[model samples]
Target: MRRIAFLLLLAVGASALALSPQEGWDLVAAVESGNQEAYARLVEAYQAGDPEAGAALGVLYLNGVAYPRDLERARRYFEWAQAKGSGWGSWGLAILYANGIGVAQDDQKGFRYARESMERGYPGGKALYAMFLIGGGAGLKQDINEGVKLIQEAAATGDPVALNVAARYLASSDLPGLSRDPKKAREYWERAAARGYFLARGFLAYDFFFGIGGPPDQKRALELARPLVGFEPAATAVWATALYFGQGGLVQNRPEACRLAKDQAKLQAGVATIYGLCILEGVAPGERALGLAYLALAAAWKHPPAQSLLSDWQKRLTPEEVNRAKELLKNLP
Candidate 1:
């Protein structure tokens, strides 16, 4: 308990007041655990149009802290906060655009909004803007040196998002002038993950689980990723797969795994494959027809494993089942 508390404190420190790691958890606990005092304070503050209060609510909706994930709701709240001139809200909207959460991916809008947030003096916004600058995304002029310098500045102030952006760039490949440094990349990623940066946590989980940059450590992957089951796409898929197959030192729990897979389905074909297989086996307590439909969905996304599974599964189905599954797929919104 002491260790966890210490780590939480460290995470809070790294967020630099702009992207607070503690934003949702404590607030959500206060609401869901029925702490009327805390709940009333939040309600009053929000009713009084406090931007921080509004942004905190937006974070709760965005991250599904003690609630069902609802990206549209999060977007609404973020918009409200942004209207009140909260840079934190701008940062949140940038994240939504960058990740296509509850909206179409629009790098131009993302870049514009992230730049706005940075200009408004938000630390997280600086990191976000630098991330876009690093890639020169969406017609923005590439400024690799400027981006790296900005990230270094933000990281010195302990901005976790800045750490994540730097680590991601270093880990991916050698840049035009900068060489890849695996050890530094690992350290930065681990620190950002511990500070609850979504991209860092997810990326680190995938890399560690598969040995992309180093030796695979399945146990470490699960340990880092379990908290992101409903929050980060790739990490959730990794954790759900581990649970489904009893791998990574975890016992099999197909029902739970399928639940996570279903939440993240269609985002990645791997998630669709897991959910489809689980549904077929009744672990998801779903119709075998629906299972085939999901596999078809995955196949449409061009996942090779899903295509193979779909082909193999279709061979065992009657023609009627195949028709029903295809019809269901067509009807899915």
Candidate 2:
């Protein structure tokens, strides 16, 4: 009876380990595509000690993507993967520690883990560690040149996050040892956009609209900006500005522009300034009080243009009206 029971336990163990790596990959793909049944199977495989599945499960729990957010569970799965010596597991732990997700925030621990993962040749870890080096946070020495080199190397691997960060660094003039190069920025942005990064599309739209980095392509700008409207307020603000000025092959429509500007103002201080200006100038007509309120709201947020406008207008209002505007500003969310 003892031998029979031992044989039965062995059979159960073999059955639990039956999933092949290829099958695991397929399940991972299915989970990414939002198949709940596949996610369940993958979870089972993770429980059986499949390191890749464990790491993937950790990410899902961390991000709260398909699974409910459970940072503790995420940490456990990451620990399992780390026990298996997975580089990605180290990277996962680094992120959690850095962000204070599942445990007390420890930047030094995070940086150490990130460096270890990078040394182990994890792509995400390389980018993350390079970022920390660039910013010089968490006791790491600042080295912009070295950081840029690492970023460029990671970007060359076509990782979407790396592509975006590298593009931004290339476009920014403020970074030491890096000059703003619109053409180069556009190249990286284009690559990231092709890989379906939506923010890249927004950046490209802004660039095309403003003639930044390349000759302005108003038509292209409008084409890119139109589809992103409603969902991307910053992009919407750009499109609305273009529409107000009749640039980018769009017909001038002050009413529509004002409407769009007002819609975006709640989310962006710059848009609030635009909306206030439209009201103050009567571009929206018969809305001076509304304009003052909008300016007050923007000014409260420390927007420079709104503050400048408010300073100039303060002299025009009676003390009572100014107090009323101040009250409105205080109440703004």
TM-score of each: 0.61, 0.50
Candidate 1 residue-wise lDDT, 1-333, digit = tens? 999999999666534333232353255446645567766666566766666567667765665534566788889888887887877678888989987888999888888789988887767788789878878887878898888778777766655666777776676556643357766777787776654455677778867875656788898888777756777876887887788889998899998899899888867666787888998878887778888998899798655668878988998888888898999897653
The alpha-carbon root-mean-square deviation between model 1 and the true structure, to one decimal in Å, is 10.2
Query: How much is 328 displaced in model 2, in angstroms?
Result: 20
Which residue segments of model 1 deviate by more than 4 Å? 1-48, 176-179, 207-220, 240-245, 252-333
Q: What would the per-residue lDDT of candidate 2 be over residues 1-333, giving only the tens digit for each residue?
A: 999999999779747754533344355446756788987777676676667677667766754435666779989988888777766678778888986766999999899888987787666578778889999989888998898778878777775446666776777556754467878888877765544344566677767766767887878877766656644554676677776778766888877888888767776555677787787778886435556777878787665567888878777767776676666655543
Candidate 1 global TM-score: 0.61
Q: Which ten residues in a row are the worst by lDDT in model 1? A: 16-25
Q: Which lDDT value does model 1 have at 79?
A: 89
